[model samples]
Target: MGRAPCCDKANVKKGPWSPEEDAKLKSYIDQYGTGGNWIALPQKIGLKRCGKSCRLRWLNYLRPNIKHGGFSEEEDNIICSLYISIGSRWSIIAAQLPGRTDNDIKNYWNTRLKKKLLGRRKQQQQLHPATTVEHDHHHHQDHQQSPTSTSNGLSNSALERLQLHMKLQTLNQNPLLHNMLWPKLHPFQEKLLLQAMNDENSNNNIMQLPLLPQPIMMESPLSNIGNMMNNNNINVSSYGGAFQLGGGDFMMGNLDNGTTSSLVWWSNEFETNDVNYDRSGSFSSSSNDSSWDCALRSSDDAGLF
Candidate 1:
């Protein structure tokens, strides 16, 4: 059933507030407060306006002691801090800063502050294009820097083990993708490393494996998961506190014990197109998914093994 209108839409003033209307609203409010019921305020004041509109105009524009100028540095800091802690609940944030309306704060954030932050980020990325690259290099140098391992983080060893465990699990599940990643070996590198370690021959050819490009090792396990899911009719998204996924498309055994916390696939670019990188370090896309050379497969194929 259709819901009833809140007020007579045809009878209300709908555009920019004229000077006379603003003066009338201001004069009416100066004589009496909102009376805690905005719906009744417009009618009592003889305004041909919706009650909600009257309330918004009064609160945002006609409120006493309202600050209409640019926000100060202190106000900016307050808004940023509150936003970080409580997110974009502008009304609550506005309550913390007196004389600042929620709508004003929102407009400032969307039009100015957000762009300012993004501009800073773009500047940094342009200034230090190799920042992440250098970071990854230093990470490697740390391990090779000393045999005793000078890292102060006590959990580093456990974290490394967890990472390897995750990589191994993903490799096992998607051998074809892993095979392409290791161009020099057909899934023999990791297996060889494990074999050498088990046989106490870790100083052999396996030692050379670490010299190879380590970026691919850090590539996400579920790298193309969005495409895989889309191809499989699986819709994955987060709601409230947990990951949610449900469809009668697959076996119940694949759904594990109600926890999708480990399935960390966070990319939204899963268009069914192929991405190609030429020798000049530029990428081009093909028109059709069939022509693409992606290592990913339909989740159906991945599940077969």
Candidate 2:
């Protein structure tokens, strides 16, 4: 059976809201309260908004004592810690923080706290880091270097670093910048990625990657050592070592340290000299395709879409 619509879709206002609508929602809620039914509240207040939109506006923006702008270190810690513990349960994380909504917390994490974490991770690597293998994603000649061959240069700790570096390189390809942002492997996934590596190193040259603990088999660009990725839907392609999904870059460091981290948002700016993509990630020049771009963006946003 099909699901019911939240309200009469044709009759409601959408997109960025108007001041009048805001005032009406705020005033009505202030005077009488939501009565635990946001779906009905819009109609009660005589505003032409879908109940979900009305609820989001009120909960995220209009509600009393709601804090807007600038997260504190405490809030950031709360967000990051909760994220690491619970994994993007924004509503739950927001509850631990006073006056912050799930949307607000989510936006901050996506745009700011994410960068902060990457910056810190990068710093830690500088002090006691993995030997990074560089690969150029733009030129096919550069990709010919191959991740396994790149790691062949590493004298110490080749096995662990080699597996993660290959996995990161295989995750997506923009540059080393893109690998740093690949989906953070779940505990099970991290094990699985390395497991695939161990199995390959001990025996075969190429192997198929297992799905993210589900029923389907996943195809990954990690076709070199088989495939490497941590998600079910996260389809990736490998060109030698540089994996290019959409943003076109990737880097992995120090996974053996077990300082577990997951994919947040892309933290770096796109290079303009030769690299270019719009907010939607469609290539502006000839040979344009954004299927991977669309896939990663949707996964990054989770259910927000």
Candidate 3:
């Protein structure tokens, strides 16, 4: 082994100092003021701790007049601005907040500011409600006009409009589908889908959707068949035919000629199937499905499905 460690490696005390240790450390530091070498401070202080431990104890725990407890409104503003500007550098943020330690600021931000920002975002989204590119641009303009518009809070209308525009934009961007699929969805269903999409969207444009609260299985298998007939656009020439249902279900009815995919929704559920057509004309179905099954737990929950 190399030479023994520089400092004693056994029975070194840890954690908050006792009153006597605190007084000894404070008194020694008051007279000598660190002397530019932490490795020598503990010896000078006549304490059991090593110099490194003494420095940590002083800076982190026993520093005179350390500000503790909740941060004020001014501090909250500074922290938010710094976070938006610099990301998660807690030490940098702490420097701007006098008397506050980095750990303190970090805790307050995690516990208070984060929740406030999330709530403000959700409320803003609910209020503005945009559904198109033009609407989002208009809302952006409105927000820019307000002098007090820091990222902390924006005009609720603007937020809502941006959210709506984004939702529509996402659906539009997917050439595989169309908005007509949801043309006649119940208001609650529309809201649920929007919430889910918002949660999934990387832009943080909408509040996350809560986990499904209950389970929903189709009341009858026929419900899926009916739903499948209403929503899909069938390509009669390529795959023999395509089918879709009213509640956002779709299917390709025949696969022998190359059409064997279908999407189905029933009892507030959704699923998709890829069927392989054999030379003998038999179609084998392999399905990949997902749905808000919880929405069917009770009649009151039906709106979400």
Each prediction's whole-model lDDT (CA): 0.43, 0.47, 0.42
In model 3, where do residues sit more than 4 Å from their true spots? Answer: 1-6, 119-305
**Predicted candidate 2 versus true structure: per-residue lDDT over 243-297, tens digit per residue:** 3333332221111113532322221111123323343442122123321232223
Tens digit of lDDT per residue, candidate 3, span 1-305? 79966568574676767989988888877886878988777766567677778877787667887798866765665565444323345775666666888878877765666545433434555653421111122345545433321121222222332233234334533321221121123333345545443433234544222111111112222233233222323222222233322222222221121342222222212111332212222122223332222212232322212
Clashes of each: 0, 19, 24
Worst 10 residues of 3 by lDDT: 210-219
lDDT of model 1, residue 233: 54
TM-scores of the candidates are 0.41, 0.44, 0.38
Model 1 residue 219 distance off true place after TM-score fit, in angstroms: 38
Tell me how far the alpha carbon of residue 29 in candidate 3 is from the true structure, in angstroms, after superposition. Answer: 0.9
Q: Identify the superior model by lDDT, candidate 1 or candidate 3.
A: 1
lDDT of 3: 0.42
Query: Candidate 2: TM-score?
Result: 0.44
Model 1 spans > 4 angstroms off: 120-305
Ranking of candidates on TM-score, top first = 2, 1, 3
Error of 1 at 196 (Å): 36
Please identify which of the two predictions, 1 or 2, would achieve the higher lDDT against the true structure: 2
